[model samples]
Target chain A: MRCEKSGRIEVSNLCKRFHKAGKDPLQVLQNCTLTIEPGKLNVLIGPSGCGKSTLANILAGYDSPDSGEITIDGSPLKGPGTDRLMVFQETALWPWMTVMENVIFGPTVRGEMSKKEAREEATRILELVGLQDFKDKYPAQLSGGMQRRAELARALINRPKVMIMDEPFRGLDDLTRELMQEYYLKIFEKTNCTTLFITTELEEAIFLADRILIMTFLPGRIKTIIDVDLPRPRNYHVLTSKKYLQIKAEALEYLIEEGRKCFGEDCNIANTMVDEFRRQADNRH
Target chain B: MNIYFVLPLFVILSFIFFIFYRQQKRLAHYSGISTLSQIKKTLTSQRFWLVILGFVLTIGFWYAAVYWLPFDAFHRLPGPDEVVIEWLSRDPYYGISIYTKEYYVHILYSTYRATVSFLLATILGVPFGLLMGWSRRFYEYSFPLVEMIRPIPPLAWVPLSILMLPGVEPAVIFVTFLVAFFVTTLNTLLGVQSIDQAYFRAALCLGASSKEILYDVVIPGSLPYIFTGLQISMGAAWFSLVAGEMIAAQYGLGYLIWQGYSLVKYPTIIIGMVTLGFIGYGSSAVIRYVGKRLMAWREQELGGLGVTYEE
Candidate 1:
């Protein structure tokens, strides 16, 4: 499929600070610059609380950066618009609405499509996400993986120019998570939508990205960008490939250094606990 | 019976029955049982028998208290049998019973006043509360005044309401509305505030206008709380209505009770109290049924895993 020329997101010199009462302001993001090319799956990997989500929120237009220039298709971004939709870390499907209603909400509310047309499109998208049979079910009725799929369907039905996924599969069980990742990869490949996916999982980042943007510990900025030359239409087999392992090792090294910096003294205590457990197991043997 | 009065009464009763029947059918549909089967199941359940046993025990206790208590006050109070007998009499000693037009008039007047006050409170209070929760500017400007006034009990406003309002009916209604209004407003405001921030962000990202957010996100998000508020407001309306009627009105259950007391007709007082309890219970049940119908999505949360019908 030929990718559309639109949906280029260029975020430059982004800075954000969070104010706390009776304390100094916390700088969450500083001098962050990245470009998400059209129809590419760009993944951002960072340590927890390293402001990766802050950058995603700014890009999605939920929160504003203190000083930054964010442009979509060469036009400066304003507040939230239909052109960019975010899939939240936690399921953001409207619990009161069924999967069908949730998916059709954007188009119907914006008057971009008639209710009949929106429902038809929503049915297709729900089918794409394997939620067609569950269209009338509420978000509360769905399992975590299913809810994420419904959320994806909701965003996809909008045909958003840029799709932002913030740890969308964070809470699913291991098997379900792996299944969802594969399912999501197939959808992404088919649509070839421009996407900026945020994750703390190195494996997930390497497996799904066309390019991986590694973020620094705090006052988060792009530490480095690793281009993934893996062929498209990939699967679980790619996880064991020679190139995948090399990329994972390099990404893990960077993440470990950043993780050490982020954890500081706490990291030493965790290591000590692990050492103690190993010693106890050796004595038992 | 007057045709004019009886016709309206028959129409209203049939309307209420129609709604009740439809609600039962819908509830059964959701539960995957027919209405008749559900009713049969409830009747056969141990819980139903336990409820009956509870009522019997309570009445038995009331009988024991009335007959055996040695206190002068206990002697002055009418027994359960005496009240029940008077309530059913065609020509009773207290001049109020099933056959009496005056008894129905009192019940109708009380019901009318409570319904009007509750409706008025809901119509005015929901929007006020939504604005208070939605806008910081509105909250800052009006919340303090609401707080200041809410602390004053509805009964405390009886004297002032009578003075300011044109007549006794308005005064009674005003007092009742105050209590219901405050309850509805506060609950609705809290309801709006309790919504997840992510839902708002999602709505914004979908390019929803402010008005769209208000309708699509704010209203539905707060419905559970709004319904809860309505139930409480309905109760408060009746509470304040009786108090207001006792002081200012010529006809109502409260007026009937006060009249019975002044006339030393103890059975009449018991009759009025029992009637009030039944009507109040009925009104609350109606509100609950309506709330459940509207918030069908919340059923799984409320009823838990057992009630969920998996496809």
Candidate 2:
């Protein structure tokens, strides 16, 4: 079900710093190199306050890195463009536009298609997101889940080469978030657009990623990369499978160790998760 | 009862028709209610009843107070009935009287000045303010001048305006326009500034050009503020119009008020005051109506309140 049109992304030693007028410079990202294969879902998971968001912003061309480069389809990115659309953590669907208007905004703005073609594309995407009924509703009029779906519809309509989702389901209730993760997997399978999905949730990463990148907090660094070899044509039922649990356990181990290092003993996930990682790391040593 | 009340009554009548028309439009989709019942429903609503009661009780109290109070007491603010009676009679000292064409002429000139000035302020200020908000350089360039000029009262411009402008009409309009224009420009600027940065970022990532962002993000995003500015501008126009006309106008509601005061005709002044009230209320109401129409998304956000007849 992978798409033929998906594009590869290369992040080479990306570094970014935030300088304050009267304060010491803060390093948000440093030496962060990652590769998201074409036609694959690469989930980047990290702890809160990690520089994942900064990296995502840099990749999306919303912000420039102090140093290093991001290339899509082997070409250096110029700036924010339709070719690389970023679905924001918060619902970024224009409240002023109805769902239909939000979906077609990219094509219309880019003059990428004829009027009839744009309409057809909008209809197809809205239907793909199961939002045809609510296409005329304002983002305010929609439920949280529907708004997320609408935002996804808005992003996918542009056929972005590298779809960078910044915790796209972070704010949803647990049930809806899980449902959205499944829904996104369905869309990802179809589009197969090289995705650099950022999240703080381990299971969400396990649920959607072909490869998972665990990042350190603050001066964000990719500490570990685990290939989720769990069988595809996947669903929530796979949560009970041994392979899924093993992968989840491995991700938790790395996340817990990184969480402990960055947050000291303060992180609850580290408190709960590091014992297992300690045992694993201790046994390895 | 008198001809002076005619225009005010006409305004109220049109206001009532507007309410009824809006109600009818909403009810058109409801199959359960007959058209007659829908009219009854609209008239009998709590808001409608409250409005009617408010007007009736206030007017009734004013009539009683004016009638019973001795002319010596409270310096004799004339009653509605006296204003109505004087409005009908032909005595220039006691009443404007239906026979006088002066009342209509004053009203016509005042309206013309206020309307022209108001239109000019709106056409000039809104875009300038929006640009100021949209672009940092524009804001930095113009904001200082706007701030420096904003505090100068419209009345303070009178002598300088009279000397600079060719005619009294233009001078008065200049003063009125200053007030409306300042309110409009500032509010439009606030509207643009109030827009969340996320909206601009979203627009940029979606491949919108700067022009498209202005149309889709900056403008529509700032509409609630724009309309609010317009409404405040409407009020400021009427406010400065009275002051402007009182200073230099040959004829206007402001002139009537001034002429009445100089001539010791309290009833004529009250009529002019009441006319000004009606005009201010009607203009703001029109602006609110237009705001409601342009901002359906806002209406949806605020749970459809203020945008509908019903809660």
Candidate 3:
């Protein structure tokens, strides 16, 4: 999906740094350059503490890069706008609103339509997400999967030019994750939206993305961008296909090499120590 | 015993009537004549009448309590009839006059001072709390002072207010404000602090300005706590009013109650106390009603936090 003539974006160099307690300053991102074309799902894949979420935040205009420019349609982006509506990793639907109300939030706030029209659009999107029956139910009443669906409905309801999803399906069970992946493909097909979806899950990236951006750990930079040439209308059955496995292996190889570089040989040993400390704390509680 | 049942019966009947009324209105609306007469016709029904009758019966019970209840130690309560009669025929020698309607007059004064002082506290305390909660520098500088001031009783401030202010009016207002200040401030701060950071990020993502973020997400999200503060501060202000007016003030309910106690006019004291209780409850009910309407989104959360009542 990379445009040859005039594409959607031009990122020169992005850098970010954070101050740490009792230590040297931590560099989270440095001189990362990546350009995304319009109407393609660009999945950013990496391990924990790899600044992938930070990158997503920068792209969504929630965070600014320390230095470097992100230009969309050949113009530098300033801050977050309805132009790039983000679906958060944690379903950030207003806990107070019903499923339908959450979906209509953008249109209502932007004054795009009358209240009645916004509600109609919300209802239509809820139906599209297969959540028509749960329109009046609050977020607490919904399961995590349904809550994610409601967030998706909310994101899609606005019909934004670029839909930014930040690991929206990370915590779900396997069955629900597969179902949501399928749903994502369907909605992407319908909207023709340029999406930047972030996830740590390799299989998920291969399944739904047009091109996957594999990022290296801390001070994150793009290691590779693997294009998925598999046919559309993808489902869980595609997991068994040879093309899917090949994409997964390529992503995993980059991830494994990055993981080794970032966390030396003692990663698992340190994690086990931390896990024991947490277990003791839990017992005390 | 039977009369006690009247209130709940009234509520249930009203509930049923409302449902029926809604159904009929829905029917009329579907048929496409959105006229006032049609809506009114649907509203006027047998169920509505039954509910009204039940409500009237509960009022009758209160009236009866005023008349029939014996004023001996066994009951230790005067009926509304006796209180009314005594109120009407009080001795002129005791500053009693028609215009004075001393009881109602005192009620008016108490209500005016409490409401004014409480409103001042809300305006000042909420923003202070917001600053204290939002910025670490503000919190570090302010929290210790607030902590020290909060536990001090309103009575403790009486000496200072009386010395500092020009008259009893300012003194009373000062005491009332001091009583409400810390609670309102603390609650507002907590309310602001307790809001999830993700909400701010989301608001930022939506291109909300700092002021817009504070108003839309922060204030609305923290309203339940603010209302909880209002509820508490209202009660504190009422309690403080009695002590506040007990100073050089001549015409407030607190003064009236104190005067009644000095003269051994037990009924007048009872009247004053009862009037204060009613005003306090009434004001709190108003706060609760407004809280319910504004924090309509937080009803479930507030309910879970043990503020539940059957609607």
Q: What is the C-alpha RMSD of each candidate to the true structure, in Å?
A: 5.5, 4.2, 10.8
lDDT to native, each model? 0.87, 0.83, 0.77
Model 2's TM-score against the true structure? 0.90
Tens-digit lDDT track of model 3 for A122-187:
777888788888888767667778889888887777677677788999888888888888887887
For model 3, the superposed segments whose C-alpha errors exceed 4 Å read: A1-7, A96-101, A107-120, A133-137, A266-285, B1-109, B119-153, B156-167, B209-215, B251-253, B260-282, B302-311
DockQ of 3: 0.19
Residue pairs in clash, model 3: B66-B79, B66-B80
lDDT top scorer: 1
- Give the CA lDDT, 0 to 100, for residue A272 in model 2: 62
Model with the higher TM-score, candidate 1 or 3: 1
* Segments of candidate 1 deviating more than 4 angstroms: A1-3, A265-285, B1-46, B301-311
TM-scores, chain B, all models: 0.86, 0.84, 0.69
Collision count of model 3: 2
Ranking by TM-score: 2, 1, 3
- Tens digits of lDDT, candidate 1, A1-285: 223656999989999999999999999989999899898999999889999888988888878999989999999998877788889889888888988899999998889999999988888888888888989988888778888999898888888888999999998889988999999999999899999999989888888999999999888999999999899899999987777876776676677668888767457664554456445444544
For model 2, name the residue pairs that clash.
none
Off by over 4 Å in 2: A266-285, B1-53, B67-73, B88-100, B305-311
